[model samples]
Target chain A: MSLTYGAIGWNRQKKIYDLVLACGIVLYLSLFIGLGAWLNPGATVETLLIRGFGTCALLLLHIVLIIGPLCRIDARFLPLLYNRRHLGVTTFIMGLAHAGLAIFQFHALGDLNPFVSLLVSNTRFFSLPDFPFQQLGFGALVILFLMASTSHDFWLANLSAPVWKRLHMSVYAAYALLIAHVTLGVLQAETNPLLAAALGAGLASVISLHLVSGSREVRADSHSSLSSFDGAGEFVDVCSVDEIAEKRARIVTLAGERVAVFKYDGKISVLSNVCQHQNGPLGEGRIVDGCVTCPWHGFQYLPDSGASPPPFIERVPTFRVKVDGGRVLVNPRPLPPGTRVEPARIDANASG
Target chain B: MITFAKWKLAIFGIYLVIGAVFAVVFLAIGIARVDPAAKGSPIGFRLLIFPGVVALWPYLLSRWIGGEHAPRTERNSHRDGSGGADQ
Candidate 1:
């Protein structure tokens, strides 16, 4: 959103976000280590550190995985989404600390290189009790490290939003790896069914949240398909004008391309559902100041032209729209990006 | 046993070399893309993101070389149908 990238463009909200996150991490670690020591008086400091940080990182990762779905389910959770990358980076740091301490304690003094020992010391990859679980953890750590490093908006801009999103989606893979790592590594050694159950619960929670949010989105899309075509097929009927909320849109997929037909200011404007900036859902975003604001990053475009207002050069394809007998009809063919089309105005006396 | 140890050492050495090369390239890219709002020295930011740069260098390098600059609007396909579906 800025012309130039600064350290983080930290504002009051971000500072508060980081401070709260720091305090929470410190509190969690203190309680976890304190409780572990109280429970087992003979537990070593290294063991406490390893377990505390590992559990903290895993917990934070569950939060990270659920944030998107949580936001989708409720708009109130959007604030968490705003500073989610910080949470991710913090989780990676905690995971790294846990890994580093484990390596130092378990493998540093060995004759072989610690990493080599990690990789080759346990060759029982398929064996339940002796499997090389550290490798799975190491693989997950690598993925998390990649995600944390490129969590910046600079990377998002440069890599393109779709690519950046795809890269971040690899977190699911990392999650799977970590789950295997823990189930095989710690759960086996500890002989604790509670630990296994907790991990299973986390896995279930993440899956359920994603499923719920995904189903909601699919239902919305399905509703948009209830349309009839005109005799000429030149303009497809999307929905009735009354079906659209003011300043909102009805998104329709026509000929494989999605178009957002917006009802605003007693006029209808059709534009590509994709935002030029991050391919954010323009259809899902409400109009702000006569422009469609992208829900993801607040990037704006004039609905008529599908062009970002001056000084911002981004553009999305526009579609020709018309209102016929209270029905909104949009042409399947998209106009060249940045091409201006007059909006079809609703008469003052038009009925639903 | 000796041959096995030598193989392990060889693999470790190769990993170290690769790690060092990635670290160096990461440092280079970090300097170029240091956050403006970041406080403290550029080196600090570089160090912070060093691991990320190393792991994501291939993708970052493609972006660094102008490979990812195509506008998203131009690439939209009917199969994908743009935003809400993918998200």
Candidate 2:
């Protein structure tokens, strides 16, 4: 909510969040190294550092990826999403450490530039098991570096939320690259089936979580579309007024656009489901302080005009609505953004 | 050993030059565009984020120059407005 960013707007909550994160990382690393040393006395310090940091970064990436779908499934996970950029930046740093040690230990002694050696050392791209896995890891690291560098509100505001979001979505590509890098690199060298099975399990869990969340959203959308329109011209029967929980909304697709009809304060207001900032789902969010709050980042809009409150300028398209025979009906034609349409008042005498 | 050292030095030199160029650009844009509310941030905070600014200067510059001016009315009047559920 800052107009000018001097640095990060770290509050008490953020301070606590970061403190816990730092302590967790330290604990994880110490335990990992200690256990590895006890289990394999022959393992060198360089090997331990490489494996520990690499595994830690991979684990963090999985956590970061799951946070999105997890939040969609349950609102309790939103706290993790709030400070996800910090986790991403820490993951990048751990990955950088792993790359640094691996290059220094394996490629630095050769009579070639370590950077060049990383690119050309194993030019067996034609061979499945013998491919240059380091190059894939390097590519994924570059993407992570880009994401971490731009993980600030300054970039989000300047880049426009949509473009910023698209840029960050490149993490999925990076995740895929890293999976390949590990499968071809570490898994090939390590003869242990346990490590390979764990990696496979992690990948499957991530994929399954995404699939389940996606199916839930599809079901919601399909349910909205299943309601048949009244024979009345132009106006469609979305749902009964009672079907929408108070302060929440019933989202329906009309004229190829998703519109959220919110029931609040004994009145119903229809607005475009897409939020003006970051395109968050407005239907999923409840009304707070008489404004429709976006669940993603808490961007708010006046339900009637679909306009953000003063000092912040954002608006969403509004739709005309009418209530007849206890059924809420909406005109498919959307009004221009910021247009003030009268809300359809719910009748007190209507039966539930 | 000598050849390896030479290659390492050459790579280091190239990186230094690139870093210097980006640092200057970052300082210019970062000072101009940082949020006014962030004025309370300490000098140490600014220094901490300086490296990130340098790495992402190209993106910052593009966004600063190309601001989002199209109001919702102009864009969403006729267009189908659909926001992503996961975002």
Candidate 3:
């Protein structure tokens, strides 16, 4: 959350995250290459490096894909979501290294251009036994390159979040392509049942986690619709005031919108749950120093105004809220971003 | 065999040629005109976005020519309902 965009808004936490990431990459590559060399005495150094980086990138991609659903399931996983972009970029770099080595080893020695050789060398598209699996890997790499290049806030700001998000969502396509790449390329030759089982387990885990989190969200929406309506459906009875803890928020679905109703300092303020940065869930965050701090990146917004503090210009939409009979009834219609509304006062004596 | 490869190479070549030109022009003159925050940004910042600009030159060029000088607020379900947008 900077007024002026830099290459990277590095802080203590980001530095620590990158340092740990570097150490992990070094450790994993060292172990993989060492074990590969010990196991296969005939394998060359290039072969070991290609396999090591390829597997590392695939593992990182799995972790990246799982982080969102993990955070959705539990708030404690928010720290993993914080530096997830760094992990994504690193994954692309590792993939590039693997692709670079593979291309050099296989195609660079030919008379033709290496890329042309790569594309034309294998024309067995119809045959499963001899399919051109490198094409799938290449397609995935192109998608990853786009994502990694545009991972900065500059692209996010320019592309307007929704478009940026949609573009990044093509990661699922990349993941699919990579899965096919591995299945056709390596699994064809390897007689190892363990590798096949591990891939199946990873695929199952990704699918199950997404399904679980998505169903939970659908249930929340359904619960909101089934609950009581007030004031001719203008206001929805979201929850009781006591249901929201002090400095914390109770998120409710209202008219197809997720609204965060926060209780703080004997007052209640309702805001759109979407964070300005990365569309993180603001309802999952707690108020810090009188401002709603986003759990993902610590982007802060005033509970009343939905605006970030001075010198920072990020803002979310506020909602019209009222308290009746210890229950919080909120107008589903949102106000403009940064619009200030009087916080609904909470009576201490009222039984919620 | 070589024909399909040549076709792919031609497409790639054209995109890179245009992208190279667009990258130079955008970084030198067009970026600051489109984004105020990028007006006096450092070389590192320019270098950082270079790849993205090259890949998305057509879209960025449209925005630049269409006079969208400011960063657009994102439209969402809640914001659309309110006839507003979010940052």
* TM-scores for every predicted model: 0.82, 0.83, 0.96
lDDT of 2 by residue, A198-217 (tens): 99999998999999999988
Better of 2 and 3 by lDDT: 3
* DockQ versus reference, model 3: 0.64
Question: Whose lDDT is greatest here?
Answer: 3
Better of 1 and 3 by DockQ: 3
- Give model 2's clash tally: 5
Q: List the residue pairs that clash in candidate 1.
A: A5-B36, A6-B36, A6-B37, A7-B36, A7-B37, A7-B38, A8-B37, A256-B78
True contacts kept of each: 0.19, 0.15, 0.71
Q: Taking the tens digit of each residue's C-alpha lDDT, what string does model 1 give over A195-281?
A: 889999999999999999999978866766634678887888887888989999888876555678899999999888877665667
Over 4 Å off, model 2: A11-16, A109-111, A226-232, A348-352, B1-23, B29-87
Using Cα atoms, each model's DockQ against the true complex is 0.22, 0.20, 0.64
Backbone clash pairs for candidate 3 read none
Q: Ranking by TM-score, best first?
A: 3, 2, 1
* Candidate 2's TM-score: 0.83
Interface Cα RMSD for candidate 3?
2.3
